[model samples]
Target chain A: MTMSEAIEGRAALALLERARAVVDPPLRTALDTLPGPLRRIALYHFGWEDADGAPADGGAGKAVRPALVLAAARALGGDPLTAVPAAVAVELAHNFTLLHDDVIDRDPTRRHRPTAWTVFGVADAVIAGDALFALALRILAEDPHPASAAAAGRLSACVIELCGGQQADCAFEGRGPREVSLAECVEMAIAKTGALLGCSCALGALYAGAEPERIAALDTFGREAGLAFQLIDDLIGIWGDPARTGKPAGADLVAHKKSLPVVAALRSGTPAGAELARLYRTPLTGADVRRAADAVERAGGRDWAQLQAADRMAGAVQELSRAVPDPAAAGDLLDLAEFVTRRSR
Target chain B: MTMSEAIEGRAALALLERARAVVDPPLRTALDTLPGPLRRIALYHFGWEDADGAPADGGAGKAVRPALVLAAARALGGDPLTAVPAAVAVELAHNFTLLHDDVIDRDPTRRHRPTAWTVFGVADAVIAGDALFALALRILAEDPHPASAAAAGRLSACVIELCGGQQADCAFEGRGPREVSLAECVEMAIAKTGALLGCSCALGALYAGAEPERIAALDTFGREAGLAFQLIDDLIGIWGDPARTGKPAGADLVAHKKSLPVVAALRSGTPAGAELARLYRTPLTGADVRRAADAVERAGGRDWAQLQAADRMAGAVQELSRAVPDPAAAGDLLDLAEFVTRRSR
Candidate 1:
């Protein structure tokens, strides 16, 4: 597909940039209110500071959810900027989940630095996350002035999905290979990851004056896209090169993570399944990663996962086609979709 | 107050009773979707289980915040049942904070059993808190119509206050006596503990079709009353009998927690204050608790706190007089205020 034909690609990026300005003030106000140490850490995590907490240009983070929110608003033919609450709300929601996920997963580095809980201590980090969670709701409460109750309620649903997804992800940590069915994993991904992304876009549409039907369709598209993205990400987590991953290669293999490929290999009940099972029983070290990766490859686990990701991508594309009637915004959305699933980052 | 009067005093309690019917089915539905082990842990934390994860009647809690919410609605002359969503939201919000607080404080017992994080890992408890946090918001989202936005926004504002208060409380941990003054500590308590209580009632009033002025008045009354309730709590934390506190005697002193009385004593700048400061400079053990308590007593800390609490109680009474015009509900509110501060619980 041509770049211009993607789902509001340029428009989504532009919308995200515009929404950033709107979200900045309340966020800064919140940061300002925080005591010196916590405020510094939080600002740094938001990509606003250097290691020493001095001010810096934008650090890291694509702000994808916020962008999708704005694009959804624009697709609804409304002032995307007017949906700033939804945009900021989604971004805050994203970071809050990320911080918690890091704590739960024990993956210390976030945006290539110490996680919030790691640097600030768990007590402070938890409060920081709660702070962001509150800020998100406050941002949403600002708009729909007369409809603040309903808007706030919408935020709760998103939080439930986001939090529930994280819970399910943690619960699945020690799952047996057979238990990690592609369908189950996809559903988990949707709950854990897609919920916020989908809800953000849907909320954007809602705030932008879209009908419920339109909002529902856009949400479907967003959910599908988010799920597909995660599936592809799981694939990368296992076999992707260290340079691309910004960490050691075969990290998931060494950890014996139940990614889609490994789970798929197990489900196939082929030669790869037996080998994968045997390999998992032993503690995986760096030396064993090659054999582990080979077991999945020989089992066609990699190919199957690739195929599954393709199917989800197709589903996402189909939803996008049906939801976005506006040519400009639709093109931008498509670009974002392609960029999100296809790129290394 | 009489037992029956205490039972009837809190308007929000009636709302909570009503909320039980409204929230039960939906809460169960959400719980059903969670994984088995997680569902059980979260259920236990919600008071649905005994320590062994077996079902028990102890799932019932005091429902204080919810009662406050309903009372505010009634004080506003609105139907208490109409505020059921707000009632459930505030109760859930209160519980969510408690779950996390237990983890951070490293306290083992909650409602006379091991805390959720103590039984389940910290990660599990964190996720469970997330579930409840989400649940609180989701409960509000059921307003079923867009016109409910005002109520949603009000709940969101309450949530922000809840978070901000928690932040202040956590920030207090490492602060020196000078960094957090007694007045500031009281202000923090008002924001942290009182705000949610006030918010509960205010939202209840909003939901009950009350005029904005009445809602505002009820909020002010609830805020002052909540602060009074917390001051009494601070007193109990340090001085209440072990049987009443369900904690070791002088638990606050053991933790070096800067309770209001302790802060007050430290600020007195008398011999007792100087003595207390010296003891505070040393790591506290159970032995030190006795010394600290003695020092506080000598400095007139206990008396000062009691007087301050009385001042807050009077302020609450004054606020209630101005906020609630209706004799019956206002009377109930006052009775409840007396019950909360006077009773050991």
Candidate 2:
């Protein structure tokens, strides 16, 4: 990576670390209110405790969403400290989705550890997820901030959209290989991934007491950035090194995941697209998985996804500019956005 | 039945019908905002549509929780009409729990039809339930009432307790028959069933602009009534007529459900309790279920549950009187509470 890219990455990491510093205490306090079994499961899911209820050093996620919340608030000239509860709520909400999504996807691992359901069982994981979500909302509800109610409404609405997105993702998995369209997949990705990010930013704007239009702009900025991040993440799912991503190469291909690029390839209507569809029709062998990846690349899915990611980043920057006119003010948000989209893993 | 009992039941039915009328429109409006698949599943779960998406008369639940909300509001000299949103929210939250609980328990049916999870698949049911909860919170967050924030906080906290209760219930199911104590079972019942009912009443009290103490009293009133209802329901699970309950007699016994009565019987320390434990060790045949039911009765489970139900009802009345001193104003709430506990099925 270039020097500037390295600087941006480090800056983003610092922002994330700062967010974690402020958010973790309140997040832990909220989670501690859960009754015994649910509390243990939640703590385990958050990497704060082991399955046996002992403390663990396993890291939670990168806190990207919480960083966005704080950055958006600061970009709008609001006190980041005042928005700490919103940041904590956003992180809690994001983790709640992770727990449920892991169960729904039957994903065995997350954040380099066994997923909560794998450790505690699906029932406990699901209930713990529900409790986390409730706790997230409770934080907002109990917050004395003037913007708390609006933030809660927006966040809750975004959660519904997130649910819809996940439901669509699951539904697409049961359909034929070519059945899911590129447009549908994009919508699902936005709902599943972008909505919460957008809400995080919007919540920051709300806490900042920004105008409605500014909040909307920040929401759009975060959403576009989130889409860019997802596109790149999906690309990594197909091509990243196992050492970097902690997964086999072309893991999405092996699972026949109708990710954005895969759907783009399937809908390309080229001969390579047809070949990819044929490979996707059956449980893929390792060789077939390699062929599927090659076919996706040959069908121009990789190029298309890369272009889409860049275009989304451009759109996100434009939205951020609208929300925060000064480049210096928008620097942290941009850094975080670029860091997410540029990550090798 | 005596003359006064018959009148009270009819009055409660009328109150429920009135609540359904006011609450259904907003509930439907809120649900209609859901995307296609989640909306279809939720509609089916609420008995507003068939699995095929056709309109059906399957009948949503009795609107008992919503009735409690409206009744509590009116009892506090508030306009019940103004509390319609709170009523809808309580109903949505109640159904959300039902959807998740059905999946967790793997129950095949609800409201005399296939449960949402059984009909729509577990993933869809789970997503639909999550959306319902988000929608419930969204309603409160959007409400302009002075008490909306407190109501939201109370509801969210109650949901956490409900999750804890459900987690405990599932854990108990995995243990030996004699391992779950009566106190633990009772606590689970309160958390699972009583909490939501209490929240319903508390929400109404909030919307009514009642003082915190009054709200607490209404919550306690609903919780006590809810426990009484659970005890009676558990008893019905074992001994009610199949024609009335739409299940085989001794259904809980056959399933070895660690319901309140079963736990009480298991903890009785009598020969009959030991016999019941032995019967619970293996899958029960028809005669075995009957024998288990008789064993529980001989171990004093039935009488214990019956007495507990009565005592809970008395406690409920005491709390209701504290919240609403005038008997005339409290009549609707009392009638509804009595109707629930007095139901044969």
Q: What is the interface RMSD of each candidate, in Å?
A: 3.0, 0.4
Please tell me which predicted candidate would have the highest DockQ against the true structure.
2
Q: Which ten residues in a row have the lowest lDDT in candidate 2 chain B?
A: B246-255
* TM value for model 1: 0.91
User: Could you give candidate 1's per-residue lDDT for residues B151-200 as a string of tens digits?
Assistant: 55666566656666667787887787546788778877887778877777
Q: Evaluate residue A141 in candidate 1 and report its C-alpha lDDT on the 0 to 100 scale.
A: 55
| Model 2 TM-score relative to the real fold | 0.97
CA RMSD per model (angstroms): 3.3, 1.5
Worst 10 residues of 1 chain A by lDDT: A144-153
DockQ of 2: 0.92
TM-scores for all predictions: 0.91, 0.97
lDDT of candidate 2 at residue A120, scale 0 to 100: 92
**Top lDDT hit:** 2
